[model samples]
Target: MPVQKMDVFDVIVSGAGPAGATTALFLARAGKKVLLLDKEKFPRDKICADNKTWKCLDIVKELGLWKQFQKLPKAEIYGVLVASPNGSEMYTPLHEKDIAERGHWYNVKRIHFDNLLAQAAKKEKNITFKEKCAVVKPIYAVHSKTHISGVTYHDAKGKTHDAWARVVVGADGSQSPIAKAVGHSPVVKGRYATNTRAYFENVKGPMDRCELYYLKGICPGYFWIFPVDKKTCNVGIGMRPEDFERQKKSLEQILRETIALPQFKGRFKKAKQVTAFKEWGLSVLGKRRPCAGNGWVLVGDAGTFAMTFSGEGVGPSMRTGKIAAQGIVRALNENDVSARNLKKHYEDALWKILNPEVKGFRWLEFLLLNERLFDFVIAKSAKNKELIEISSRMQHDYTLSKKLVHPKTALKMLLS
Candidate 1:
């Protein structure tokens, strides 16, 4: 097969999801030539819970895309409803001030959400957006095998091509080829989560909030009901891969059983599934891994920046992309694309912003492992105004979440 040589760019971002698109958009806006490639075409569906919090909205607002985002088909999420294994439920509104200021958070289908970002990237004059482009591997420097120089991919016509870039970003999801080619691995074992989601029509429930059910059978994980629109809902379940495999039950089976539980019986009685159950892997954020190296950087799931407790990746992923772009811009300006330089500016800065939350969420996940402990926390939050306020604020601000995981607070929750 003849390999075609394409124009060299300042940055080549693999996987044009939220991370890739955000990175490309920022780089392009800064006047850098960017090549954004993805395996799937636009308007494609991606496996996700479709939930977006204030953090995500902040990014969208920064990009000047909030008005456009509001125009997409979505459901407003006023708060979160968490149900414990023992049938105890608690509703934590997403910060009273935030609700009053922003109305509500949102749940938009990934297909639409991703397409919106990709489309925005397309409008940037410096960005070259290409769909149906599948990146195969990182192209290493001939003299140094460890240094990535560019990438080789197959275009829509099945033609192989070599595209060079000063920096290659692995914004791809969990199973990223660039991550493996760059010798990056998950820092923590059993940190990945397996999730399955499907769309349902006429899901009988209040469409104003997202629901999370923490059952005994799936400790450390939860089943979610996220409304996507007036008549449709994104229903899904997530679990640690080991726990999922140990149960010896398929996601579909677990989901079926979960819906039939006494608490959710009537909610699905009038609901009809409109889509097949689709499974995906979430590389939940835990231990920090190498994200930037010679001529390459990883963002999104490829960098394992997804939230540990909520499996929320969109906000973190996009935030990392923005941060990575800032670092890349500085590296390009300095004419230094070496691993040492990129790692110092990119990885270090990214970790500075992400490490605290990742560590805090990891501890929270640990506490939720015990059914009785988890139930106690949820039940208490229902009656404790202080605890409920802290929980609600934690969803929007990581600083507040740290307080919840503080030794003092943890001890109080444990004893109470």
Candidate 2:
């Protein structure tokens, strides 16, 4: 593609992660000239577990990248093993079609998975996917000085340049420049989580199932071991910032101690941690934040779409990217860039799908976080198929989220 005027872009997307790349792919398909910018290079390493919700897969398919995804290395998972703080354990089978379109869930490393999205965006003729270019600040129109005009960025070699667009999409992570420009705060204590991710090899456990252990001090969050293949598994622990601070131990130290507990003695005796543990921050939607403003909109972590209870990210990121693109396509046609315009066209549509979900699951999060109740529920679910089924459906199925907080459901889980 030949260089054009700096102002020739329909949309400028900040960050080439899942949300930005997916948004660019969709907008390009809609015939928009898109500039997808990222500070990192392609095939960059992101510290994360090997879990991809079927919804994430659906977006990959929608972008016509399914065939490419199929060729990547992954583990086919069919069920989950959940253990309580007191060591009570339950195994719940995840049914196909109910949870995923592929009839199985997939677990692939973030390094490979994210790079695939960036590559797909580059394939679009209308998209200029510029890696190693970091957006420095927003350029506001002089007249309004409220809506975005474009952005100034520094390239890989630190050369500064200005790029303009009719609309700007902030698909950047939690600390998005565009989001800040629109008066958004990056982290609020209750709505955020910190996670430490690592990989382990030669683990002794069921290779086809995901394992989650609810630990003391880390209510709602869990230490998870997800299979990446026959020999390797992605392992991690997630906790609210407050919980992590209270523990007063490094994530690496806590992880090691937890593995030494009698309940996990057998599983990790032969296992070797294959990667250094890395800690990162995540913003979850315990409460929704405004996403659209004057000439700009936020998606993915910038919008706080990670599930409140599960700390889920990839699926929601892709989902918002695709949904936002639909609204942006309409906005482009209508030539409206006001905050109110995008509030109706984009934000409303997004929250309609997300509002109830995060609100309902926070109830589930509160209920199961108590150590005694966590133990009781796992013990009962082990013997009662109904309890196990309902527990499995609490996620991926939204109908039960509201009921999960009902007094009847709480009593049923406790007494029945």
Candidate 3:
């Protein structure tokens, strides 16, 4: 922990989020020296629905850690209910009566769940976990335009430390320092995304299931009420950055009005706000080249790999981190840590896991914004099982439209 001593690690991971921690866990399992660094301590709170999807469960199971997660306390689910502005409802059941089938998913507190996962990496003997460390700059091997060799960071004591590694992985959040250091910085615009959220405890009025409300003008940006516990839930709204700007009200003010709706009037009357409402920009990935360069690779939000539709990143970040680690392991084994070698594996792994979903979400996003089209789909899907199922897949991938039977119904409606 001394700043005077320069530490050399085989792989240095920045930002101990899902991606970074998973990368460290995999690297340690591979018998490599891994150093995991984070600006904040473990078990931190994040703004999200905190629900792990079926796809996420499958990935966790493949990692051999699914059983452990199953043992944790889980939220009960009857089904998900989608309510449209026109009073139409689409319900999807979460439980499967079939013996061979699994249920949809479970919701948990990120404070507890993320800590548990991060602890898994800490349990590995080869991984060095450091908290309260902010990465200041990436150490480049050649000139500033070349490969990154390591990082210069400041620890909790405000003492600076230089870490040298063959490869560095940036698993930081949307606002990634490593990404900026590597020159793949997020381009923030008022056009792409606007964030607003409020968490509630003791929420009432028939919220046993996840509820999504698609307000008419809000289009692509809907409101979500996700159950966190029997008595606690996260209720918030997200909209296009442009729409949010036009409202001329703070996100908090808008959220207060949203909760005052007829449906939520009595339910959240006594609800407690766990945290103050705030807004942050969502970074929609631009058409950038690969996220990895010589001796450096980016994972999770640092790489702009978040699927914009659902605004969920934890599961994807974990998968991305694991893939980045795998590539590092392969390159290290071959004694070739070139950016090209590591990038090929990282990019392939990311696209395989997320590209389809990203495309699908983008399409849904487009439709959600088309007021007339979105209203038609919502109204039509209210009672149509086929329409409901297809629209649901939009959250997974917008490309589902291309594969849906009778896709013309929605396409023609939207186009018209």
Winning candidate number (TM-score): 1
Clashing pairs in 1: 294-339
Q: Which 10 successive residues of model 2 have the least lDDT summed? A: 95-104
Q: Is candidate 1 or candidate 2 better by lDDT?
A: 1
Among all windows of 10 consecutive residues in model 1, the one with the lowest summed lDDT is 396-405
Model 3 lDDT on a 0 to 1 scale: 0.73
**Model 3, residue 165: displacement in angstroms?**
0.9
Compared with the true structure, what per-residue lDDT tens digits does model 1 show for residues 295-331?
9999998988888778888988899899999999999
lDDT of each: 0.86, 0.82, 0.73
For candidate 2, report its TM-score.
Answer: 0.94
Q: Order the candidates by TM-score, highest first — what do you get?
A: 1, 2, 3
Q: What is the lDDT of residue 308 in candidate 3?
A: 64
**Residue 70, candidate 2: alpha-carbon lDDT:** 84
lDDT tens digits by residue: candidate 2, 25-52: 8899999999999999989888766678
Model 1 off-target regions past 4 Å? 1-6, 100-103, 186-188, 402-416
Residue-level error in angstroms, candidate 2, position 141: 1.1
